[model samples]
Target: MKALIIGATGATGKDLVHQLLNDKDFEEVDIFVRKPIDVQNDKLKTHIVDFEKPEEWKNLVKGDVAFSCLGTTLKTAGSKEAQRKVDYDYQYEFAKAAKENNVDDYILVSAYGADPKSRIFYSKMKGELEEAVKQLHFTKITIFNPGMLERKDSDRTGEVLGSRIIKFANKIGLLESQKPLPTDILAKAMINSSKIKSNGYSNIKLGNIFCFAEKSND
Candidate 1:
């Protein structure tokens, strides 16, 4: 199968690309990014394009599965509109392109607590993206909602501190459902969910994401 990924430079996206390159199930792995990455593999293809100008590269979204992991934090984006551009506009554009190109499987990395009617901005944006993609009517759509991701070598102070707090809580047998999820495991679950033969939509929450990742290859 051919796999197309956005946000390949991110923590989860990096893990996903590595896993896809190593997995025998995927014959080709294509990544779209603003700049080129250092990794090289026979099955990997890199497309450095401007996300703001999708018309130039929208036709290149063809693949068996399209994984959308692009996201941004308010601190990094500097404004709500800027964050929306990356988290919602960019991902939605990619998904729209993939659907137009006839890609059947769509996998998304959404955050936990996402709801279209969410009072929080971040959750509302993610929820809105989920609804927008659903309107596209893909043959298969898998959305993963993970809480407090345990990114490898994460530099964000808030994320680091939050993860530590969650870890401590988990050790005390509290908030186990909110335990931080490793990026690699989430990547594995995304790939594994694509292999499922089901038609229509699937919403994999925090606990279910752990199970899917553990049983991915099975």
Candidate 2:
């Protein structure tokens, strides 16, 4: 299968790209990023495109399946408008272009509390993006909502602390449903879901993601 990926540089995206490039089932992996990726493989291709200008890269989004893991933190983005651009506008644009190019299958990495009617800005943005992508009418759309991610070698202070807290809670069987998942596991789940023979849109929450990933390993 030929796959196109957006946000291939992020934690989950990086893991996803590595898996796709090495997996024999995937013949080609095209990644759209603002900067170059250090990893190189025969099956991997990278496209450096400016997200602000969608017209320039819209045609290059064609592929069998598209994985959208693009996101930005509000702290790093500096403003709500900037965060919205990265989290909502850019992602929505890529999904729209992929749909236009006839990419039938799309898998998105969404957050746990995403709701269009969310009172919080970040969840609301994600929710809006989810709603917009659903309107595009892709043949297969899978939304994976992970509660908290345990990234490998992550330097983000808040995420590190959050992961530890969640992990501690999970040990005592508390918040089992929302246990923090490893980025690699989430990546595996996303790829495995694409291979399933299903129709229409589906939402795979954190617990389901963990189950699917384990099932794939079996």
Candidate 3:
């Protein structure tokens, strides 16, 4: 199977790309990026294109599955508008192009507590993107809503502290199911979801993600 990925340089995207390249089920892995990635692999293909201009690279979105891990933090984006552009506009554009190219399986890494009607800006944006992508009518669409992610060498102090707090809470059986998950586990779950034969749209929340990932590993 040929798989296409966006945001391949991000933490989760990088893990997903590595898994896809190593898995025997996916014969080819194509990554679309703003600039060239330094990885060298026989099954990996990198496309450097401007996300703002889909016309220039939309045609290359053809593949069996499209994994979208594109996102940004408010601090990194500098403003809500900039964050929305990356989290919503860019991701939706890629999903639209993938649908147009007949990529039947679409997987998106969304966030927990995502609600279109939410007052929170980030959750609202993620929820809006989820609703927009569902309209594309892909044969298989899986939206993964992972809670706080524990990434390796993460620099965000707030996120790091939040993750530690969540972990501490989880030890006492508080919010056990919603415990912060590692990026590798989330990536494994996303890859496993692609192999399942399913129709219609499905949302995998934090607890479900952990459960499914554990079962997949077994």
Candidate 4:
């Protein structure tokens, strides 16, 4: 299988790229990024692209499956509009191009509590994106709704503290369902879900994400 990935520079996405390259199931892994990366691999194809100009690079989106993980925080994006541009517009454009190129399978990293009618801004945006992509009618669609992610060397103080708190609670057999997921584990789940020969849409939520991650070990 050939895999096309966006946001390959992000934590979950980076791990996804690594796993895809090593997995025997995938022959090629194409990553679309804004700037060129130094990493080199025989099965990896890195495409430097401008998200605002999808026309320039949409053709290269062709592959057996496309993984969409591109997103930004309001703090990093500086505003809701900027965050939407990255989290919604760019991702939607890539999904659109992938469907147009006849990529039948699509795997998306969405958030928990995502709903089109959500009052929360972030959840609403994610939910809207989910709906838009579903309308594209991919042969197989997997949406992972992981909770707080435990990123490697994360700079976000709140995320780090929250993970520690969750870990402590988990030790006491509390809030295990909300245990922060590691990025690599999420990546594993994404790859494993792609290998499953299923049809229609599957929304892998918080507790289910842990199940899929554990299956990665098996």
Best by TM-score: 1
TM-scores for every candidate against the unseen true structure:
0.93, 0.92, 0.92, 0.92
Q: Which number leads on lDDT?
A: 1
Q: Is candidate 1 or candidate 2 better by TM-score?
A: 1
- Tens digits of per-residue lDDT for model 1 on 1-218? 99999999999999999999999999999999999999989999999999999999999999999999998899999999999999999999999999899998888888887888999999999899988887887877777888888899999999999989989999999988888889998898888888888633344454635211211211
Candidate 3's C-alpha runs over 4 A off are: 200-218
List model 3 lDDT by residue over 16-108, tens digit each. 988888999999999999988879999999999999899999999999999999999999999999999999999999999998998888888
Error of 4 at 52 (Å): 0.2
Write model 2 residue lDDT over 61-135, tens digit each, in one string. 998999999988888899999999989999999999998999888888888888899999888888888888878
The runs of at least 3 residues in candidate 1 whose Cα sits more than 4 Å from the true structure, single-residue gaps closed, are 200-218
Clashes of each: 0, 0, 0, 0
What Cα-based lDDT does every candidate model obtain? 0.87, 0.84, 0.86, 0.85
Model 3 residue-pair collision total: 0
TM-score of 3: 0.92
lDDT of 3: 0.86
